[model samples]
Target: MAEKIDRQEVQHVANLAKLSFDDQALSKITPQLEEIIGLFTDLQKVDTDGVEPMYSPTTEVNVMREDKGIRSNQREALLKNAPDTQDGLIKVPAIIDESEDGDK
Candidate 1:
């Protein structure tokens, strides 16, 4: 069945979406929008009794490995590749904000 839609309702939607369509555009869109709504209404009429609701289309499986602490290379070995380091720590320039106290 074709769903009937009011022109005012479409105009209200257009206003919300910040769209300004002339009379010709409104006339063209109304029937197309009605057809899409009708198709969705028809889809709701299908029987899905006893069928499990699907949260995901694919079958669920865990690919995660067990959490365990493992020994890694020392801090010196990791820092050796850094372009610049100071006092055994990675150094970055301090970012000063002029408006730091304005909001409070």
Candidate 2:
């Protein structure tokens, strides 16, 4: 059975999503929404008794490497490219206001 999506339901969904649609747009989108619901209803009739549930569509497995401590002496080389540095560390301008207490 095809489910019908009324203008009120569409408007309610729009309001939930913080969207505003005029009468023309609402009329146009209602049919599309109904069609999508009908497609889902059709999908409910499919049989998948022996099908395995998939977390992802692809069959790729993640290969993990053993954690080995290897240090590089590239700090001095990287520090040379920095635009601003302080006490052997990169310095950036403060973005947040620390003076403002949690009152706001």
- Which candidate has the highest lDDT of all? 2
Q: List candidate 1 stretches off by more than 4 Å.
A: 1-3, 48-104
Q: How do the predictions measure up, each by TM-score?
A: 0.42, 0.44
lDDT, candidate 2, 1-104, per-residue tens:
66678999999999999998999999899999998888889876879789887778877789888889789989989999999999999999887777665757
Error of 1 at 5 (Å): 1.3
Clashes in predicted model 1:
0
Question: How well does model 2 score by local distance difference test?
Answer: 0.88
Which run of 10 residues does model 2 get worst, by summed lDDT?
Answer: 95-104
Candidate 1 residue pairs in clash (backbone atoms < 3 Å): none
lDDT of each: 0.81, 0.88
On TM-score, the candidate that comes out on top is 2
Give per-residue lDDT, candidate 2, residue 67. Answer: 89
**Model 2 TM-score relative to the real fold:** 0.44
Q: Write the per-residue lDDT of candidate 1 for residues 1-104, one digit (tens) a residue.
A: 55677677789889999997789998999888887887888866778899888888888796988898888858898888887899998876667665786866
